[model samples]
Target: MQKIVPNIWFDGTAAEAAEHYARVLPDTSGRVLMRYPEEGLPDFQKALAGQPLTAEIVVGESAEDGGCRIVLINAGPEFAPNESISFMLNFDPSRDPDAAATLEAVWAGLGDGGEVLAELDEYPFSPRYGWIRDRYGVTWQLILTHPDGEPRPFVIPSLLFCGAAQNRAKAAIAAYTSLFDDSGVGMIVDYSTATGAVRADSVMFGDFRLAGQWFTAVDSPEPRDFSFTCGVSLQVNCADQAEIDRCWEALSAVPEAEQCGWCADEFGLSWQIVPEEMGSLMASPEAYGAMLAMKKIVIADFPK
Candidate 1:
């Protein structure tokens, strides 16, 4: 299983979104998990009964596994996807003969009910590139990869620290790298000119490794109406309770935001410090009930 996975929250469209991606993207698949009402928990059960609560999806292929696994949840409309976090899709012609065609197909599929943030065109960064927000409000940055540059994963999560968090990208990257084993900071390019609210010399673009996964981050100077929310989060699956506690101690900043193993870091990015055995324990209604009542997960509550 992936140690760290991206979790996407949607307003009851998680299953539909997952199905769309499974059909549109090559080498991808999705499975939905429903939440049925349980006895003795009237309010909680009533709120989630018969809901297609979660969707697990795999996209692209990885050397360690088939692809990246993401969790999607129908968690209501309290939060919505924004540019604060987006996925970057890299299509390398050298790796796939049908790269260009695949890119066009994906662009059209995603653009069906989406709005283009950056039109596809040649830029100094790549020959073909575009940024778009899909119907579900999830943003994606698609680029025809340069054959000469270092190879990267098929899909990578990108963090844009905008608004009040502007210029704090480096700090967040540092914190994450330090928290995860086998992690390190990579190339970082600073902004050359002040753009809107962002200052020059702040991170323009950078890459970092956390738990052996590469993720990009940038300090966007552009003003935005939204900041980081629970709409998107990074779930870190720990080997044991010790690992979970350590991560929770290091990453959690807003005490009030901590709930059911979920927390918000100092940079406002959300994270879930979950135990590796959570999947198996969650199968039991009693364990699930215990999970709902706790702020942080307790392994002892679930029987081995």
Candidate 2:
């Protein structure tokens, strides 16, 4: 299982967004998991009666076999996705001869009713690259992978440290590497050494491995009005309550933001420190009730 899964909050379009990705991307599929109670919902969730409570979207293969997995959160419109967190889709020409064509097709599909942040064109970094935000407000960076570079997963979550979080990507990576097992920092390119517009000490591109999963981070070269939000959170599936406690103690920074296992980090990024058996525990309405009354998840409180 992927130790860390990206959780995306959607006002009411998680299922729709997942279906759209399945259609536009290759080897992708989405399936609804648990749903809200038929009745007796909290005031904030009354609007989501029979809709999908959680949808598991798999991109580029299967999550069970170690592929890219994302959890779609069905919640209210209190939050919306922004460019603070964008997904990187890598199409390696060496792997697929039609990688370029496939990139074009996927770009066209994602462009439907969406806005392009960066045009698809050849750049110093990659021959084909572009950045776009889908109609649902989720952003994606598509690039035709360099043939000679080390292979990376088909999907990798990319973080943009902007606003007050500038020049903090390197520190964040160091902190995360300290927490997760089998983790290490990958290639890093600082602004002083990177091409294009230059600045001294800021990270232009950096990647890291957290519990064996890959993620990329970059310090925004320009100022932005947005920072991380609960809409895009990283969910760490713990093996037991001990693991959850350890992670919660380390990553939870914003006390007021703690709710049902969701918490904000020092960098304003949100995270969900949940148990591996979350699905089974949530099957019981009593467990669900117990959860809402708590902040950090407690396995003992959840009755089977």
Top of the candidates by lDDT: 2
lDDT of each: 0.85, 0.89
Error of 2 at 152 (Å): 0.6
Deviation (Å) of 135 in candidate 1: 1.2
Where model 2 places Cα greater than 4 Å from the true spot, the runs are 62-65, 193-199
In order of appearance, the predictions have TM-scores of 0.95, 0.96
Off by over 4 Å in 1: 34-36, 40-47, 62-65
Looking at model 1, the pairs that clash are: none
Best by TM-score: 2
